[model samples]
Target: MHTFAPKSIASHWRLIAGLLPWLLTGCASAGYQMPDLSLDSLLGSDQAAARGQPVADIGVTRCDQLTTHEDDWDRVNGVPPVDGEDIDIAAAIPACEKALAEHPGHRRLQAELARAYAEAFRYDEAFRLSGQAAEAGSLYALIQQGHAYRYGRGTPKDIDKAVNAYQSAAKAGHIGAMNYLGSTLYQRDGWGDRSKAESWYRKSANTGNATGMANFAQLLLIDGKQEEAFPWFERAARQGNAFALQQIGTYYAVGGEPAIKAPYTALSYFEKAVEKGRPSASVKAAKLFIQEAGDTSSRLSESERQAKVLYWIEYGMPKLSTRQ
Candidate 1:
């Protein structure tokens, strides 16, 4: 593991679909969409030993749920949990609350519910649920408490307290705690304490946290330490980290010493990344394909490059945007 900034790599959660995108929505109703795709096989499907049945169909309507008052679509804006994105605050909140009640005692479920409340700007409820969750003492639950305190979801702003909780969790073997703590320190922008930010990132990476490794690599690469960063990126990529794949693609595209900057190699990495189902990488790879192969008018070029962008936008973005 290496040291890097929190934002240096893509956010931890962004790797969900690629790392292991399984549904946690708990929507066991008649209309839920269940794509039967496994990310590992997704990229190699055409050449796969056998074509697996789709676990869920993205096109499923879930019609009644969409319009039902109980489904909570009213509050969601259809955006994802990615930072800098918007979500339907009001409807989503009630939906999550309803879910929590139905699946009580599931810490991940409660944490998500609390997070939804926090996302919707409902601090009181977020705090309440997070409190209950923290009492459960789950890693995700403790992280929720940290979220409540630092972001003032229910309590006043207190960086120190949030840091303490994160540190405690990090020490207690919560890998995500390392991410949270590292991110907080990195955001501090204490020029004199840049090392401190990197230190926390190392703690996170040492925890075998994929996000931490990705971020650490990102930090090193951005700082012109690609020599050191490549290993970290490889570490995360080995775990099916789409972001790391994209980074490797970039290295290949650029032709570094250890990594030959061959468009073919880059394409291989990008295509693999796209197959593993990283939307951004799909788009990036598509963009690169076009840039390298020229415009869509060429018959051969069009077939190869054009398909990349289509899937990236059509199938990729929607799935990513709708994900929690």
Candidate 2:
């Protein structure tokens, strides 16, 4: 819902090698197309700026100044649902539409309105404005275009174009774009540029991208640096990545050397992850709860075990299916 300035694109990728792990959370390069679903919970420009590198410095409209169009822009950014609630995505649409009607040449406003459109499931409008913003050098808009192209939401599904879009944005120092570019290049069946992918992930991770941190950590684990990877996973979890939260649960449940196996601790983490909207957490919690209950040395009673198992099977599996 906010706009940032774009960055200058870099021509070549840089690599810093040590060790890497398997990405538990899905990456863009895994041959997975964009889901034909709501992009409601977006990685907004404001959130991205808070997380990592600052984008190009686009000016914010002053609230005190009152050109009707500027006032509309301020309202779109400051008003109820878009400002805090985040649930009612449609609330800002009219304000953005009115502002654009009066100021169609404003590129930042165009990108912001495009994102509002995307959140409202108006892909055709989203794509049009995003393309305009990209042409005007908006890094975030380039990322949006990548999403549109990948999903065939408002355009044909073109993996090459999506990759190009992500790459372009990544070069411009967009953190999400860097993470996505890494994902696409890292996939074995896809472009399969391990070195380039790691470089991209490292750049994002270095800039404090939570997904990048988790992904880079996963690769590190794969390379046998469990000790090194644990801290990155911890960092990502602290940043509220659902995948990292669930992975931490898995870590505790299936403990490695230097980490004591604690099923109860694992269950606690799994429960927290579920509360954070990860379905995998439910499966892990249920599995571990049942395991602990079934273990003869444990103190859980027969009634408690039955109750827990029933709760998970009856409540968790259905939810997991829906997530898939």
Where is model 1 more than 4 Å wrong at Cα? 1-113, 119-121, 190-192, 275-277, 294-304, 310-324
All candidates' TM-scores? 0.60, 0.66
Name the best candidate (by lDDT): 2
On TM-score, the candidate that comes out on top is 2
Candidate 2, 113-230: lDDT as tens digits: 7766776778899899877766655566777788887778779987667767776666445566778778876762344567667777887788766789889988887888887777
lDDT of 2: 0.60
Off by over 4 Å in 2: 1-92, 119-121, 188-191, 222-225, 294-315, 318-324
